[model samples]
Target: MKLKDLAHSRTGDKGDIINISVIAYNEKDYPTLEKLVTVEAVKKFLGETVQGEVIRYEVPNLGAMNFVMQKALRGGVTRSLRLDKHGKSLSSILLEMPLEINN
Candidate 1:
């Protein structure tokens, strides 16, 4: 299954940083989402596009996880040569990550 199967994403980017929030559709899914979405996992999933560190902040009360990805925007929307300079597509890209949760 994919992360999108359990949650949704909201994103923001500035300079070379990207911030993402993954919120569970059902509160019960938060535990699994938290376990599957880790700093190392996100770093690997996002690959070289994110040149700096990835930090995960848990929002258990809200059933959400927020990620601060450094060096992700390639110098932000104003300077990036990439099509999705603002890194808005990152939200959807992250949602595509495969999750190993059990049925």
Candidate 2:
């Protein structure tokens, strides 16, 4: 399965940092996401796009996880030559992450 099957994501940018929030559709799915989605996993998924540390904050009550990626914007939106400087599409890209679904 893909992460998108269980959750939706939103993204934001600040300077060279990127913030992505994954919110589970159902509360029951939150635990699964919490276990499967780690900072290292996300960092690896983003690859060279992310040049710095990846920090994850769990919001158990909200059934969400927020990932703060440092140095991820290629030096901020204003300076970045990349077409998607804001990295809004990154949220969708993250949804493509493969998952092992256990029914």
Candidate 3:
């Protein structure tokens, strides 16, 4: 379902980009997770509350999904030092996403 339920997240904000990697415990569910963790879907979840360009990468080996959010940090490093805090919340937020599988 949610990213937190499925895996752990590591987030980094550098310059204007926010990078998040979600690692799943059960690697077998990667395919299904990938389907639900699409760039567009993540973008929708983040919404206008934040601004960024989202890119998703599949790491089947690690059973992880990496999301690169561009320009998410509005004020850059100096103005907003909230990257770590935001990252923590993002991990949990991602975990809450529901997964769908087609048989």
Candidate 4:
């Protein structure tokens, strides 16, 4: 399975920083996400696009995690020539992360 099977995501950007919020469909899945989703994992997944650091904040009460990625926008929307300068597409791409389904 993939993370998308358990959660949905929203993305926003400020300057060269990108913020992606991954919200689990149920509270029960929050723990799994907390364990499997790490700042290192996200940074690795994003690869060279993320030139700075990745910070993850857990919101257990909300059953969600927010990832703040710095220097990820290829220099902010106004300066970038990339079609998806805001990095909105990154949320969906992040969702593609594979996960083990332990039933």
lDDT of model 1 at residue 34? Answer: 87
Return the candidate ranking by lDDT, descending: 2, 1, 4, 3
Model 1, 26-67: lDDT tens per residue?
Answer: 999999998889999999999999999899999999999999
For candidate 2, write residues 24-74 as lDDT tens digits: 999899999999998878888889989999999999999999999999989
- Residue range 37-96, candidate 4, lDDT tens digits: 888888888889889989999999999999998999889988987899999999999999
Q: Which structure among the candidates has the greatest lDDT?
A: 2
Candidate 2's displacement at residue 85, Å, is 1.0
Q: Candidate 1 or 2, higher TM-score? A: 2
> Residue 80 in model 1: shift from native, Å?
0.6
Per-residue lDDT for 1-103 in model 3, tens only? Answer: 4566667777777776778887877887677777777898788877763586688888788888889887676655556667553454666665666665457
Q: Is candidate 1 or candidate 3 better by lDDT?
A: 1
Q: How big is the positional error of residue 59 in model 1, measured in Å on the Cα after superposition?
A: 0.7
- After superposition, candidate 1 runs with Cα above 4 Å error: none
Against the unseen true structure, what C-alpha lDDT does each candidate score? 0.92, 0.93, 0.72, 0.91
Give each model's clash number: 0, 0, 8, 0
- How big is the RMSD of model 3? 2.5
